[model samples]
Target: MDLLNNLALGFGVAFTFQNLMYALIGCLFGTLVGVLPGLGPLATIAMLLPITYGLPPVAALIMLAGIYYGAQYGGSTTAILVNLPGESSSVVTVIDGYQMARKGRAGPALAAAGMGSFFAGCVGTLILAAFAAPLTELALEFGPAEYFSLMIVGLIGAVVLASGSLLKALAMIVLGLLLGLVGTDVNSGVARYSFDIPELTDGISFVAIAMGIFGYGEIISNLSQSDENREVFTDKVKGIMPTATDLKRMFPAVLRGTALGSALGILPGGGALLSAFAAYTIEKKTKLKPGEVPFGQGNIRGVAAPEAANNAGAQTSFIPLLTLGIPPNAVMALMVGAMTIHNIQPGPQVMTSNPELFWGLIASMWIGNAMLIILNLPLIGIWIKLLTVPYKWLFPAIVLFCAIGVYSTNNNSFDIWVVALFGLIGYGFIKLGCEPAPLLLGLILGPMMEEYLRRALLISRGDWSVFVTRPISAGLLVVAAILLTIVLLPSVKKKREEAFVED
Candidate 1:
C-alpha cells in the first residue's frame, strides 16, 4: 500500500508538463549520440552536465538518467545495422545482430531488442523502487567505521570486475586518490597540494576532469583514426514488427536477462557492459530449441537477451547511488557530481528529506523508456542520416562545446586550461591501457572515505583496532580482503583475462 501511494506521488510529479519535455529531449539526444559510433553516453553526459546547472534538481536527474538508458536502446541499432557497436555494452550485439541484418532479418532483430529493452527497463525500475527503501533502512545503521570499510569493499570490487589488468586499475585508483588530496584540509587551515595556485585550493573541478577525460579525450582518440575505417549501413530496413513466434521465443530470454542484470547492477562495477557480456554468455551456454538458429548465426535470443540485460543493468545501477551514496559505476559517479551541484546530499536520507525528487526520478525512468521505444523505431532513419555527418566537423563542435561548458562552471579561464592539461593526461591513460572509470570512482569516494576514517579514529581515540572491533565494519573488511585475494591468485587472474577477451 505504501509502494502504491509512493508511485502515485511519483507519477503526479513526473506527469507535470515541464518534466515530460525534458525527458523527451534527453531521450532524443541520447539516441542521436548513441547512433554515432564514436560518441558514447559517458562523454555525452559529461558534455551535457553543465547545461543542467540551471534545471530543477529533479528535472536534471531525470533527464540524465534518461540519456544513460536511452543509449542502450540506440546502441543496438548501429550494432545490428553496421556491425559497429556504439558503446562497449553493445559489442556483443554485433555478433548475432549484424548477422541478422546481413540475412535481411534486421527488422525482427531490432524489434526484439527494442521491445525487450522496454520490458527490462520497467522491471528494473520496479525492483529499484521496491528494494531502495529497505536498503536505505539498513544503511542508516552504519557508523563512520562501517562506512569507511564499505568504501574499501567497493574499491576492491571495481578492480575485480574491471575488464583489464588488475594492476592498471589499482594504479588509476591510487592516482585519483592523490589528485583528490590537492585541496585545503577541512580539519586544518593549511593547504595540502595547492602549490599556491588559487584554482587548486578547491581541488580540480569535477566538471573539468570529467569533460577533459571523457569528452575531449574521446574527441582526440576518434579523430586520430582515419574515416576510411568506418562501415556505414545504408540498406533499407523492412518490417519493423516481429512475428508471434519470434515474440514467444524472446519473452523467456527477456525474463532471464532481467533477473540476471537486476542482481548484477546492484554490485560494484557491474553495469551495462558486464551485464550484457554475462547475458550473452549465459544464452550461448543454454540448450537451444529444435530448429532454432545456432548461437552465432543471427539468433533472436542473442539480440533479445543482451539488450534486456544492458537496459536493466543501466536502470538498477542507481540503487547504490540512491541508497548508500556509493556509486557503483562511472556514470553513477557522475550522477554524484550532478547531485552535489544541486546542493543535494545523495544518501539514505534523500527519501525522507526529498520525497518528490526521489520518487519523481523513479517515475521519470518509466516515461523515458516509453519515449525511447517510440523514438528508436520510427526515427531510425533520422538517426541513420545523422551518421552521415563527417567526424572532422563533429569533433570541432564537441571541443568548442566542452570549452564553453567547463568555463561556465566557474566563469574562469583557468578551468579551460585545466581541461586541456587533463585531456592530455586522459590520452596517456588511454594509450597505457588503463581504464579511467575506476579513477572517477576513487576521485568521488576518496574524500568521503578519509572523512569517515578520521571521524572513526577520532571517536576511538586513535585506536586502530576500532575498525575490526565493530562487527559490521569487520565483515566488510573481510569481504574486501577475500576479493583482493581472489584477484591476485594466478589461476583466477588468467581466467579473468580470458573472460574479457572479445569473441
Candidate 2:
C-alpha cells in the first residue's frame, strides 16, 4: 500500500507540464547524441551540468536520467545503420547489426533492438523502484566508519572491474585523490596546494574537469581522425516492423539480457558497456535454432540481447548513487556533481528528506523510456540524417559549447584555461592507455572519504580500530580485500583482459 502511494505521488510530480517538457527534451537530445558516433552521454551531460542550475531539481534530474537511458535506444540505430557504434556500449551491436543491414534485414534488426530496449528499460526501472527504499533503509544504518569502508569497497570494485591494466587504473585513482586535495584544508583553513592562485582556493571545478576530459578531449581526438573513414547505410532501411518469427526469436533473448543487465548494473564499475558484452557472450554460447542465423552473422538475438542489456544496465546503475551516495561509474559521478549543484545530498537522507525528487526521478524514467520508443521509431530517419552532418562543422560547435559551458560555471576566464589544460591531460590519458573512469570516481569520492575518515577518528578518539570494530564497516573492508585478492589471481587477470577485448 505504501509502495502504491509513493508511486502515485511520484506520478503526480512527474505529470506536471514543466517536468514532462524537460523529459521530452532530454530524450530528444539523448537520441541525437547517441546517433552521433563520437558524442557520448557523459560528455553531453558534463556540458549541460551548469545549465541545470536554473532548473527545478526534479525537472533537472528527470532530464538527465532521460539522456542516460535514451542513449541506449539511439546507439543501436547507428550500430545497425552504419558500422559505427554511437556509444561504447553499442560496440558489440556493430558485429551483427551491420551484417543485418548488409543482408537487407535491417528493419527486423532495428525492431528487435527497439522492442528489447523498451522492455528491458521498463523492467530495470521497476527493479530500481522496488529496491531503492530497502537500500535506503540499509544506508541509514551506516555511520562514518561504515561509510568510509563502503567507499573502499566501491573503489576496489572499480579497480577490479575496470578494463585494462590494473597498474594504470591504480595510478589514475591516486592522481585523482591528489587532485582532490588541491583546495584549502577544511580542518585548519590553511591553503595547502593553492600555490597563491586565487582560483585554486575553491579547488578545481568539477564541471571544468568533466568537460575538459570528456567533452573537449573527445572533440580534440575526433578532430584528428580523417573524415573518409565513416560509412553510412541510410538507404538500406526498408521495413519498419519485425515479422512474427523475428519476434518469437527476440523474446527469450531480451528476457535473458534484462535479467543479466539488472543484476550487473548494481555492481560498481559494471554498467551498460559491461552488461552488453556479457549479454552478447551469453547469447553466443546459447545454441541456435534449426534454421536461424549464426551468432555474428545478422542474428536477431544478437541485436536484441545487447540492446536490452545496455538499456537495462543504464537504468539500474542509478541505485548506488541514489541509495548510498556512491557513483558506480563516470556518468554517475557527473550525476553526483549535478546533485551537489542543486544542493541535494545524494544518499539515504534524500529519501526521507526529499521524497518528491527521489520518487519523481524514478517515475519519470518510465515516462522517459516510453518517450524514447516514440522518438526512436518513427523518427529514425531524422537521426540518420543527423549522421550525415560533416564532422569538420560539428567539432567546432562542440569545442565552442564546451568553452562556454565551463566558463559559465564560474563566470571566470581562469576556468576556460583550466578546461584547456585538463583537455590536454585527458588526451594524454588516452594516449597512455589509461581508462579515465577510475580517476573520476576517485575525484568524486576523495573528499567524502576524507571527511568520513576524520569523523570516525574523532568519534573513536583516534583509535583507528573503530572501522574494524563496527560489524558493518569490518564486513565491507573484508569484501574489498576478497575482491582485490580474486582480481589479483593470475588466471582471473588474464580472463579479465580477454573479456574486455571487443573483437
Per-model root-mean-square deviation over C-alphas: 1.7, 1.5
Query: Tens digits of per-residue lDDT for model 1 on 103-138?
Result: 878888888999989999999999999998899999
Clash count for each candidate, listed in order shown: 0, 0
Where is model 1 poorest over a 10-residue stretch in terms of lDDT? 229-238
Residue range 1-503, candidate 2, lDDT tens digits: 77888899999999999999999988887777766666567777887777777899999999988877666677788788767676677778888998998888887788788889999999999999999999999999999999999999888887887778999988888887888899989898998799999999999888899889877776677677777767776787789798898898889999999999998888886567788999999999999899999977889999999989988888899999999999988899999988999999989999899999999999999999898887788887788788788888777777887888888888999999998998998888877888787888889999999999999999999999999999999999999999999999999999988887856
Superposed by TM-score, candidate 2 places the C-alpha of residue 44 at a distance from the truth, in angstroms, of: 1.6
Would you estimate the TM-scores of all the predictions? 0.96, 0.97
TM-score between model 1 and native: 0.96
- Over the full model, what C-alpha lDDT does candidate 1 score relative to the true structure? 0.85
